[model samples]
Target: MATTVRRAVLTLPAAPLGPENPLPPLAAPGDVHRPAVPRARDGEELPPAMARRMTWAPLRSLLPVRRRDAYGRHRQRTDLDALVVENDRLRATVLPGLGGRVHSLFHKPSGRELLYSNPVFQPAGFALNGAWFSGGIEWNIGATGHTTLSVAPLHAARVPAPDGGEMLRLWEWERLRDLPFQVDLWLPDGSDFLYVGVRVRNPHHHTAPVYWWSNTAVPEAPGSRVLAPATGAFHFGYERALRRVPVPVWDGADRTYPLNGQRPADYFYDLPDGERRWIASLDAHGHGLAQTSTDLLTGRKLFLWGSGPSGRRWQEWLTEPGTGGYAEIQAGLAPTQLEHVPLHPGGEFAWLEAYGPLAADPARVHGEDWAAACAEAAGRLEAALPRATVDAAYAAWRPYADHEPKETLAAGSGWGALEVERGRLELPGTPFAEGTLGEEQRPWRELLRHGVLREEGPEPGPSLVSAPWRELLESAGPGPYTAYHLGVAQWHAGDRSQAVRSWEQALRYGCAWPALRCLGAADRLDGHPERAADRYAAAVAEARHARVAHPTATALAREAVEALLEAGRAEEADALLAGVHPTARSHGRFRLLRARVLLARGDAAAARAVFDEGFDVDDLREGERALEDVWFAVAERLVAGDGPVTEEVRDRARAEHPLPVRYDFRMGA
Candidate 1:
């Protein structure tokens, strides 16, 4: 039997490998070379070649493979222990945590996101020191994000005067997590403060152009009677005062307005100077809520009361028929576009109004008691609003306010690490990935080809799309234009059912031009051609009567005319287009419609002549493609059944026109 002798194995710890450490360096120039030591049998040195191989080669050759594996495992354990020591040394020398102070943290149930402060960094221009607290109002920011409100300041003002006069400002604060956002106001006293206890949804930073209404909910009771001073007609189309006699309520016989058999509409009015409007809502116990707003500088008062119904029964009481009411007072700010005001970087833009609970009858409480109650209620509202904190507030607010936070990568995470092991990926290789690139390219190429509109001045056509139109449609919120644009977007996106729903909803509130057109288009597409025709007709009429002028109204009216003509109601279409003042150069399209009507009645000669003349006289520059389409349809019809090309048709076809040929002759096409 052969006996095998085993030698005891020894392991060495791994040394640190860095410039400062005395561990073995990686192979580099001028490094020291150490002589190898070899194992010997019974004090006899191994062969020179074997000794060199043992020193440089892996352990597998000198011992049984399994024994070498054991030796390798022992070496790994030793190296791991050394690494643990090195890791602790590095930790001792490094900075441990972030440098900033914790300001606040919030957990929003709706979004389910955790917002916390980082102690390492602070935003410039402010300081924060506070414990994270909960329980605040939720407000929508720009119709997309929600922020919490902590404290709402009742008053705020700027330091310097821009117009060389004393300006008093009032603002309301929304403590968004840690940051503070404000809503500013200018009161009569020249002293301004933040507004209190109002939810402003879909607020813009400095560029708010959409319409907003202040919605207030008041508690109601059976004996509650509302009194509102009206200047003119109510904004809603309901009768302000209904009486048994035809005499006007202005004749003044106690104006006992009754809501017993009638539905009251929402009323809005402006207040006149030195006028005080009152609303008395009395409960069975003789206690009720009264709201009042005073123009401290002008001595005007505005008031409103709850009507106990599900909705407020609005009323207008005019001290004078021509003027004097809340409507008049508010009118000063009417046609109010928030973009007109100059707001500071983080400053907020807001409208102001005062509201509180008051006694139904002035005699029920002493003057001092009424004042005290008003002040107390106002104070509570002030406390419930949001306020701004410094530095860390911004960081806390943004994480919660952003639309999609989960998709954002953590700082220092490499892009390469985000890829899946086996999947196809499409990365953006260039900017201008959106359709905006096409818009930019078109104008540049146009300028290069046709040259600039004015060699050294601004371009002749609009350099930018109208902001008011875009703002009214694009800004998030339930507004006239927003509803209108939503319908249009949905319609264009091929969601005809949804588009119809949106347009119908918009019409219930108030009719806007785009909304009416969209509704008509949707109705037409959904097999309600008659209803669609009615909508188009109504839109044209409304545009003609609109108080505010819009350029798109003309295009919308023309579309309505076309819709009516295509529906085989040529007489109605003619009557509508008759009022439109088409220029000599632009009358071709309208005349073409007329020719179509004549052709449908089997008057080929008349239709052919009308089309020839209209087609020849029109500029047809912008809608060249449409012009060609019409020409093709007419030519195809005339040339049908071997009819010769008439002189009028041949001359018309020779005109320079460029358009594709696609014609729809169906109802309301």
Candidate 2:
């Protein structure tokens, strides 16, 4: 014989029978026409008159059916009696609202049919619901009104697996009190994967509300790539952009965006537009997962990935201001900031996004047609179109690199940081003015137009010369060349005190030719002949170290030789120029300096020979240009005068040269 299973039954107190009840009316037709009577309220019992007034009226008369009981005896009762008796038994044994209402019922003996129903709403705005199956378990759902603006629902179900194991489901919901929001979650069918979501709506005017962010965990194996479209490259905050890592500029290239390579503490605020519309895929060996977020309204895409265990705990939430207040949108690994959108009043935002598993062969991945298609798509979305706006904004934030200034001698307060011929010049930590001078090369061609630096000014003076230089220098940061130029400028301004101070500071920081000239000039002015010689020697040494053609260094050496000769140190000055061959010897100033040095040693023949070799008969008749004239006059006195070249001859030489010749090192050969 086969054994049959049965459910245990419990009995309870009977409910007060009345004609007004649907059960009694179904059982007796005469009970349909009933005289209603007022019920007792709070501590009051029903009066006999009221009870008698509630008696049923005979609206219709019908005979009851006769049926055979288990004992084979005749029972005077109809099918309606059987229904009423079963209903009474149900009412007596099970409470009406204990297991909630029957939302939907299915008689799925074969377990192939699926049925669902909308949740029920009760009169007091509370609903109790359940689903049951024959020979199976029952699921119940209930709700309770907590306050005027809050309500909570509870759900209970028994989930059966194909393996005969059963799981119990228990979940709760709490509607926000006095807020236009509700949160709910469920362990549907008692599965480990929980379905969670939140709905937020505002009935009044639109306003920005603060939403709390939740920790989202992602799990995966190693070798997963997270792809996203960034405005530029990811900043680790340790170094400047583009220079920090090996990322190419906004031009389309195959360089890594440096997203996954960043440290955990690093955060990206405004990503480049190209990188924003990215899709990141995390793959482990061959098995991998891909997630893409698409804005339903704008159709913008954001791609993300995860790996190594944390991927499983990943969740997405939309929240309001309160503890434990949020709506869980996604329950698996998902990219953050996927669909950041503002919700407007009476506006609905929906996203059409997906997550799926993929298998890729590592050897063939890069060459695969599918991989090519993905890359092409990514390039089209992020790499093809130029993000001019984003690039412009980023460019605005980047530090500028201006050209080195040209002449620092003519320091003017109105001079700008940039100029056409000269690049830029300003005191350290001071702002670049309207007009300045700078180097010959176009340094900022990559940033602006190549000819922008060459534009002429409206008028003459500092404004005409300094404007371009100021523009270029204002864009640049502190550099060695800039400091050197500034020191020279200080020296030329006749502020020898300040000039020496600035040059010393520059040397302490870094030694350059301009700084050396300032040092030498300051030493000569301060009567420190030894220090001036040392500065000139240092300049030559640095020039050799740099191994480049530096006119400034050569000029400083020449000046040092003259100063030594003035101090009656002819042998020392000659020794300084031992290996240094004079280039551009045809220049009038070069011959003049050589002539002066030769005359100082009383070698009148050699001095006259230098003038003869360098100057033409007409050039000599031209009365010498400034410095050359002074030296030529001294030579005339040495050769034509009978005795030593006296103070009167020196005064004539000084008048010819005009004291300072304004040596320009920037002049071309």
Candidate 3:
């Protein structure tokens, strides 16, 4: 059959991605990764310059960190719009609205699903903003963490392909880095592989830091082995350190097997320079999925949620029960996901990736010798689909990349269009048309055209903190609303003192709760926790007096109560929590705060009872140990045995009271 591309609707049980938090994300949450000493790979010293570059331009803050925590466990069967690209030997399904993810890739001849297609649409607090789902191939672009666009849409259209067929192109402007990127997926006639071409363009006059990782989720079964063209890897676990270790075998076990480990971890394969970049996962029968990309996309990695209880629980939480487990084989632009490559002004990085079924001899593929196994898999991949062929395909797709869309398959956000209008960017291939602009961009568009931001709504809408937007906000005439937004932009730009000053100026003009909350955050960051608590309390009080029962008010209460508890003012925290609106008190996050307050007030039983009441924090962050840690703290208090809590007592509590499976979201052992 000839290659084809068409639109379709897929029905799945999906949890609603609720409305975003109204608060502007001033500072970023703590970096989840713990600082680990850099270990030499294969006994060779990592070049000093390269080491420094890897850590350069780490994200401090960015716009649109919207909290997607309002979703609940209730899921209703919903129809999602999707695009399918197929050929004689393979079929690829793409969800344009959901980050343009390759939702499914099936090997037709083998009758096997090459990717771990998720069965349900469950949004979790995994993305840099929030609301990320598992499975399929996720295009992770932007900073070190998952892209803020993980759950957002991408502009999708049908573009002419080199093989005279049509390729599905998904493009969007990534606001975090202020760059445009596109992913074009097509299947060639009579080919078993699905070819994907990705391009990230820096249209600005200055250089920008860029990160891209194509995360492909493949099924994981017992005896499954992941192979790559490397003998060693930079192993990073939830413990927060990247330590170089030997491939296949590490810490007395073959770590390549997903089931061999007991925690969530990342193994960034240290591929030698000039080596073909590829990663594959094969089952006991030696039949599985493989992904190979051009040299420009150089990194390859394996991520596994191991056989531990927490890992297993996470797997179950991400999908429906009885659904099999999966592991990720990722390819990126850097050696590891921790690094961001520099894209010079007007420079663009483009590469082609091919994913398909790979069959090798089981013995050699999972052989005891890691190098031999990798060589065997690499040889098979070369024989099946040569690297030269992928390169030629990329070359062929370059000209067609500029082809205008024959049909618009889906619509993404209006931020791209707003950026295009503001900068007058002439991107021929990926058009961010003026027609796509929506309400979110209206105020900013007015500010761009005129000189003032008309904050004309009950709540301040989304924020834009890009360099150009900041410059515009600065030039606009001064006012309370302008100062509030200007402070947000300043905070994102790392102008901490100026941001605080601007927020204070806004508060003096009677800009009540929002400015107070921002000042609270600044105080906390400046190491004045007591003053931070006071600011937060004042913010909450102002919101209460105004009778603002909006989500922003709820967010304020949560932040204030936590701050009060942190300042060891348990009575004040409890009083503030109790005075909040009933809806806010019933929220899962607020309930967690209530429990914390009770515990701080020396009421451990009350805190324990809160856990026993069976509440679920819909926006539980990935790798968050809050629930587990609190459970242990409560357990320690309960098991105090008439003595003050000590190290031995804590150990005894942990030993005597095993963490309930429902609350166990620990990322490490």
The prediction achieving the highest lDDT against the true structure is: 3
Q: Each model's TM-score?
A: 0.26, 0.26, 0.96
State which candidate, 2 or 3, has the greater TM-score. 3
Worst 10 residues of 1 by lDDT: 62-71
Supply the global lDDT for candidate 1: 0.30
- Which regions of candidate 1 deviate over 4 angstroms? 1-477, 492-494, 547-550, 584-586, 614-669
Q: Where in model 3 is the C-alpha error above 4 Å?
A: 33-45, 545-549, 579-584, 641-643
Give the least accurate 10-residue stretch of model 2, judged by summed lDDT.
Answer: 80-89
Q: Taking the tens digit of each residue's C-alpha lDDT, what string does model 3 give over 216-280? A: 99999999999998888988888777678888789999999999999999999989999998999
lDDT of 2 by residue, 423-461 (tens): 322222122333432332224332134423222221101
- Predicted structure 2: lDDT: 0.30
Residue 302 of model 2 has an lDDT of 17
lDDT of each: 0.30, 0.30, 0.86
- Tell me, by TM-score, which candidate is best: 3
TM-score of 3: 0.96
